[model samples]
Structure formats: C-alpha cells, structure tokens
Target: MAKRIVIEHCSGCDKHSWGTKHDEAKYSSLAMNIASDIEGEASVRNIKLEVEINPPLDRKRFVPKKSESLQHVYFDKEKKKDIRYPRLGAFEIHYVEGTSVAKVLFSKIEAHRFPSRHDVTSALERIGLYSPAKDEEEGRYMDGDDTHRSSSERSSHNEDFTAVRMDFLTKYVSPLGYEGEEEVKKMTVGPPRAPTPEPEPEPEPEAKPDEKAEEKAEEKAEEKA
Candidate 1:
C-alpha cells in the first residue's frame, strides 16, 4: 500500500474524502491521525473540522485549514465544562448522519466557530464524553477553572464513554468479531477435537543495512580486482 500523510480523524480537522483523489495502489492515504491534549498524552480532541489544504503561495509547504461543516453541538452554559482532559477521547454519542461512517455508531459533534479547550469540553460533555467523575457526581461533569484536575488526569479512571458504545459494535456488530475464525465457526457446540491450526510462515526479512553495504563494497572490489 502506498503511504500518504493525512490529517483526518483529527477532531478539529475537516473530513477529506478520497472521492477522486484516492490512490490505494500508488499511495495509501493515512486514515488515522495523531492527537494530544494540553498535557500531551495523545488524547483525542473533538474538533468538528474537515481537511482543506491551503494551496501554497510559495509552493514550499501546504498548510491545511480547519473548515467548518457548519454544525453545532452546544451544551448548557450552567454545565461548567471549563475543565481539562475530556472524559472520552472525542465525541462518541449519536452520529447525526442517517448512517454511521464505520460499523460503530458515534455521537455527532457540532463544530464551534473557534474551538478552545472550553468550547470543546462543552461539546464533549453534551454527548456524555467529558472526563469522568465520582459515581455520586453523575449530574456534574467537572470544574470550570481546571483547578481540581487530577495529577493522573491524562490517564483518568473515568468511564470511557466512547469505548462503552464501541463495546456493542465489537461484541455483536462487527462481522470479523472479537473471537478467532475457529471460534466463529462454532456457536453452541464445542469443536475441541479439531487440531490446532498451523501458524502461517513468516515473510523473509528485508536485506539488512550492513549486509547491503558490504555487498555493494564487495561488488566494487570485484570490479577493481
């Protein structure tokens, strides 16, 4: 597969479809993106954006703009979403699309004109994705000032709301399934009598860097000799 850098799957970026630009054979466009929060723990940030490359005026580098889909997922101002590290990576509640992008159903995120930590948290919490709190504080999300944030806020024990929704997809929704092929073949009855499947032969390793260089030097020496 060809490799290409893509800023997709980044919450604040715009969605770039491979309608005509798709080059699976020559270039496998990057499907996933890298995201992180203020603490920089690779947390998912919900940025309602699509990918829009700014044609280079100088042709040196192209910067992509975060264009709006013109959607909005607002939260109650009284909810107080001024905290850091939203509960879930990004939104995973109710995808507004008539159908889901993947097999998993995700919550729709309405974009803000400018998504600050405050605005993003508000939207995330609206879809039940803000960072988790005590079970007793179900109604509340977090403090506005980010003062009471935990030292382990990066890896908080809060319920991963997005994962909870995905659990349904993995257990029953996906055709591939969580179990193996043999497990899938059997449903109610046991097939324990079946012998263990043979492991697939590994592909030959790539030529080592040092060996290649030595071979090149030997070839040169042979020509000189």
Candidate 2:
C-alpha cells in the first residue's frame, strides 16, 4: 500500500490512455491508491479525468451470436457464478516524474493483466480501484467486442489476443469461474494495494500571544475613539 502516490504521467508514454476518449478519471484511478495522501503537484502539461464506469452485471448469458445485424448482448437466463465484491473505495490519478515511474516504481510493484472484461472489475476491486463516476457513466466499460467488432467470433470461446483468449477460457472452460483458472497460478500478481491520496499540507502556525493581544487592543482603542 502506498501512503502517497503520484502518477508522474508522461505525454511521451502511450499506455496510460488505453481506451476511450474525453476520459482522464478512468486512467487517473490507475495512478491512485488507497492513501488519501493524493494531494501534490506535477509537471503535467494538462490534467483531465473520466469518471466513466461499467454497469452492475445484469447476470446475462452468452447465447449463440446472431448474424452481424443481431450480434448485440442482452440479458438472458444463464447464471454466472456469483462473484463477491469488496467494500467500495476511491480511485484517482497523481502526476509525478516520468523517470520516477519507469526506473523507481513500476518494476518493484507487482501488476496483474485482466484476462477478460469480467476480470477487470475483480482485479480493480481487489486492488481498491473504484468507478470515479456513479450514475450515467456507470457500466460504460469497453470490452473485446467494443474494441474489435470487425472480425466476428465463430464461437464466444476464442477472441482477441492471448489475454482475451485466456479470459474467455476462464469464464467458459474452467469449473471454478474466474478464480479457478490455471493461468492465475502462473501470474505473479501483487497483494491488495491502496496508494494514499496526496496528503494535505500542514497549516501554518497561529500568531504569538503578544501579536494577537496587541492587534485586539488596537482595534478596541480605535472603536473607543
């Protein structure tokens, strides 16, 4: 857990903005941790955030895909294993130095690659990440289909690259839902972490007793006059 975290974002690096437009809060949450010590300054050329979110699962099922015209996802009767979520938490980004992120922090910190869209929420929750937005922006998370609708899937079983394929298997192939995947063992992930938000600076001290009384006496005499 980080008592204080700084995103130290770089316009030079491309991965920070993985998807979507007009959304920085989504990415800021990536840089944020559990620590409330999130107050700080950065060399950021600009700062913006997106409080976008994916909606609560409707508990839909993966029915056979219709033709291109009918390939939309809908709520059906197949029940996915009920997944327990953690207590809610806050999420945001901090601006820090680029060199600090690449050299000092990233390698030492453990990271997890979400195998599926389903896995994204779990991993984020496990790590204390939250949706910056609560209302309309909820459930707007983009998935494999959202990112790639050009090539249709023969089966919902295999799609996207290695990560997506692994995720699909975790959902369909494994008896134990996502938690019961073999790839999970191979993945060396970090423990639950919450970086502190920036700490508020300590306030300046009050004036001395003499200074306070002297100012008060002056006001009193002025009022009398």
Candidate 3:
C-alpha cells in the first residue's frame, strides 16, 4: 500500500508573523525534518508540505482590537505569540489500504522536541507509521514506565486515547485525505426457487362386456335344461 505524509504549517503564524526570522526558521526546519523522515521511509510514495497561504475564516474568533484601527478583529491568541494553533502544525499520514487517515497535531511543548531525526522517527511511530510493537516500546520509554504490560493492554490504555484524538480531529478538521467516502460492498439477491409440481390423479379402469354376455348365456342354458 502507498503512504502519504503531509506536514502542514500554522496558518496563523504565516498570516501574522511569516516574515519574522525566528518564525521562518522554525517552520522551515519543521517542514524539512518531516519531509526528510517521510522520504527516508520506503513505504512513503508521496510527501507534501502544505502551508495555509489563504486560510478560511469560518473558525476565526472575533475580538475587540487593542488599537483603534478597527472595533473588532479576528484574533488567534495561540498563534499570536509564535505558538501554533491547537489544530495547526499537524501531520496527516495516509495509507492506501484503509479509508481512515492518521493525524498528529504537535502542541507547543511537543514541537520543541521535534528538531532531531530520532524525534521525527518517534513521532511517526506514535502515529502508527512504523512497527506497532516497536512503537509500544518507544511509548513506554518516553513515558518512563518500566512496567511490562501486554500489547493489548498497552494499546487499550494508550492507543485508545490516540484513536479518540484522531476521531475528534477527523470530525472537526476533516482533512483532505478523509474527504472521499469509503466504498461500500454491494450485496446481490438471487431469484426465489420455483415451487414443486403436484402429482396427477390415477384413471379409473373400464368394465368388460364379455363377462356380462357369458352370465346371460349360462342363465339361458340353465333355464332350457
């Protein structure tokens, strides 16, 4: 199956502080590292980094402007101070085998740890891009929990939360990877079986005329005798 990895930039960062040297370097490094990791993966067929040059305004929060330029303005407090919006700086990993796509959105705290190649690989592993068992080990190491737990148990506890986040993001963001509807299998119905035929009635036997004639002749002969 083919894999596609998308590294998305923060729209708020681009709109507000794109020209700033610090912001430029931050996003650039993030994009470069993600692209490198995706390209390094043999399973990845396509790698793309999409920046929101013209992000939509549907979710824009209107706040009173501090300056007198306007009474109210669209405000993104999270992205105003170089922090990514809750949904921004996300990675969308798609697999051709399944309809559902895996999504990862890095918090401000997490983004700081993503500069290294190891962190990039670890990020992919967390989003289920690599071996699941290996990912579990890495998760344990990262969490600093040495207790040995069964795969199912760990997955139920850890992976289940990831699944819930995936569900929430997919429902809210509804990324391009998940736009198409899943193909539904069609079921065929056969014609009903023909009913059984009924049996025919038996015909009645015809009486013999010779037996009547013999009886008459015998009666006449007895009368003459």
TM-score of each: 0.19, 0.17, 0.30
Deviation from native of the Cα of residue 89 in model 2, angstroms? 30
lDDT of the structure predicted as candidate 1: 0.30
| Tens digit per residue, CA lDDT, model 3, 1-225 | 444554444433444434532343445445554465346453332333332222333344333346543322446554563223223444332222223344543433354322323344456566655554654564432221223354555544333222223332333223222222121001111244587877887777786679889999999999999
Q: lDDT tens string, model 2, 1-225? A: 222233232111222234512233432333332111112111111213122122223333434334443323333445533221110121222222322321222210122221233333333333444332421143222232232232242233322233344444543334223343654434313243588799999999986689878899999999999
Worst lDDT run of 10 residues, candidate 1, spans 25-34
Evaluated at residue 185, the lDDT of candidate 2 is: 31
Candidates 2 and 3 compared: the better one by lDDT is 3
Ranking the candidates on lDDT from highest down gives 3, 2, 1
lDDT of 1 at 110: 39
What does the lDDT come to for candidate 3? 0.40
lDDT score of residue 48 within candidate 1: 40
> Evaluated with lDDT, which candidate comes out highest?
3
